[model samples]
Target: MNIIQIDRHSGQTSSQILAKAMDLHASGDLHEAEKEYLAVIARGYRVTEILPLLAGIATINGDLQVALDRWTTFLDLKPSHLFGLMEKGALLHRLGRWQEAVVSLQAAERIDPNNPDLLLNLGIALIDAGRGHEAVTVLKRVADIRPGNPLVAHQIRRISSAIVPFWHIPMLNDQPRNDAFEEGIKQAIAAHGSTARVLDIGAGSGLLSMMAARAGAQNIVCCESVGIIAEVAKKIISANGYADQIKLVPKNSKDLMVGENLDKRADILVSEILSSDLLSESVLSTFEDAIDRLVHEEATIVPRAITALGCLIESDVLAKYAFVDEVSGFDVAAFTELAPTRLPVHGKLTSWRRLSDTHDLVHIDLRARKHEASYRQVDLPVTADGIAMGIMQWIRVDVAEGVEFSNPPDHYSDGGWLQVVHTFSRPISVKAGDQFALIAGHDRTSLILMPAG
Candidate 1:
């Protein structure tokens, strides 16, 4: 594939030319050094070494294609050249040849699988190639090799942030949600017996699967779509001694097949895929698919019900997301239409007064086979006299009989979950004892709440 295939030019003075090239290269005279290296290369005297020197000189002189061609030529002569592959990959990445960059680095990786530098280059190229999940897996291996390397850690963090949602790390730290899920899993095992096949959707860090294992559920299949998370979850599950009991699959729940990705239909379903306002994670569709295709009839579903609860509130901070009137000297109220429909709010930190008592915005029974997106009008009982900005919503998970969790605004400050404020098209005025009409429901993927006449 390289055009630099020249016939060997045998000469008596080849050694002399190579020595002068080395001297010129060391003296930083790259232009002169390149000439001599080319002379040595043309003479077929240590062409491999001379080619790399000539390529490096071309790269320094800003002739990347020439450098790439030289590397390609060298590789054609000696395809298994390890450093050549790495250099070629790095150059390919710089040239925005994404997939080719990954392929080259991967070739180098196959030769020296555990070399940290090679792995690092491969990981970076994978990110640029849009293979973020695999990049993260590779970067994690680099981290294991060079523990204190800041660049690898930063790359891992950057790639992870781009691929995984920000809430997962915090969600893992949500003790109440964790405790409720564990309790529910324990009860399910008690009722279904330890041998019941369990499916954990949105496996995340494999926490729920591990919980099922702790409760003595022997057969667990957990699925997570994100590659890096799935790989790290395997390590965590193994570290916790549940590797044999739990099987992790990097796939969406909808794509999983019974008897293929699962032994049979699941007998117990353990999942915490509920979003902040309850449905933003596509919980309805995801659960519906699993119930229809993956889980068996009468499967014990954790959090048999979820409630989206909220109160109409007034907040100066939240108003900014809803409306704008005078800026400089213009009637900019129309600009409010371009504002965000909803925003995540930390209940304790956000300044707001409830205009009405918390009401059930929407509720879904997880055991239901299907959910239809629908809306209904609610007569919210106003408890105070204030301007109603919008509805401030949170979630309640009824895991089991006595195991339930709700991240109410006043208490759930640190959880990965946050109360979402669905800003109204315009702020509405209300008074104590006035029943405010509101439209409330979900589009299946997000909670929808707005003002009603």
Candidate 2:
């Protein structure tokens, strides 16, 4: 029997060599341990067992190329080896060879599809390859595999940037938003009477039209861009016994015709199309299109209008997210580079101070026929001194009557939509009355803000 030596030159057994390698690994003598493992590998002894050990040693020694080679070698011998495949895939990912990483991870997933680690890696590899749709599928699978996982949830959100349809933004649901629209509809009916003709554009839930119907509107036309959501909205309307009072138009607001759908122009137009910062939901274009093509020249637009409100704030906690710094034995300053070119932030969870109190940013008159991209520089007076983490923003919609309603700071809670706190480049300090200049505007989808002179 050919006895394979584990100790290489010392003629020890494979088990003894592995023990030495593990001890070296434990003792932090990675380089010698790697050499010993490689010597055992050279003797053709227990390749499968020793390969991962060698790869790990190479990784600890900062020899990524060697580590990758060893892992790849191990996978070739035992393709179903889960850890080896993961190591190989991760190495490729770190090297920025995302396509190759995808291939390796897919191989791993085929062997062990239920592994959330492999699924996440596969999703990331797909994302790096710019296959966002595919990434979304895998990420969602990872989400399903590990529900409530922040990392999985985060990847799902990242993939959404590539797939969110033009209409998904406003159609998404929120309790505060629904209540605001419902209350507005009630007031509109109280003021205009129940016999008024109503049109609800971007009718996500068909809720507004139902509100109008309950408020006494004889005829209500509701339009939604998403086919599935529109179908659900219709079902909801039918379930609520308002099927006869509401007409669901499963199409974009621009597709609605005045004579065919309405039999005449509408007396009222009610919609809740405000995104986080109001304009991000494409309220300008959608409302502009509906007003120009569908709404009556003098319609009572419930959410007659909406204004984006904001304030500058600062915080150390926010800096961790929006800026670069070191932490926990690692130079994580590279993390700052990972900050989104733009991102939606929550103000309540962050630790920041007010550099400026809330002020009006931009308002879209929903009843206007056409809206041009507009901008204005505003001076926000700082009421207190604090590190400026970001701009906290929310919406104030003009519902009806002299009965104006606002989601004041104290009551402004979280849901599908909340105050978006957009972080600054660095924290800014200001004394009382220091004016923070900001340039604010909208370009169809979302509101943009930046420092202004």
Number of the top-ranking candidate, with TM-score as the measure: 1
lDDT of 2: 0.75
What TM-score does model 1 achieve against the real structure?
A: 0.80
C-alpha-based local distance difference test score of model 1: 0.89
Regions of candidate 1 where Cα sits further than 4 Å from its true position: 1-58, 63-84, 143-148, 157-166, 238-244, 328-335, 431-435
Q: Weakest 10 consecutive residues, lDDT, candidate 2?
A: 164-173
Each model's TM-score?
Answer: 0.80, 0.59
Q: What's the true lDDT of residue 399 in model 1?
A: 97
* Highest lDDT model number: 1
Q: Candidate 1 — worst ten consecutive residues by lDDT sum?
A: 3-12
Candidate 2 per-residue lDDT over residues 186-243, each given as its tens digit: 8777776777788888787677787788778878889887655676789999999999
Backbone clash pairs for candidate 1 read none
Regions of model 2 farther than 4 Å from truth = 1-179, 190-192, 325-338
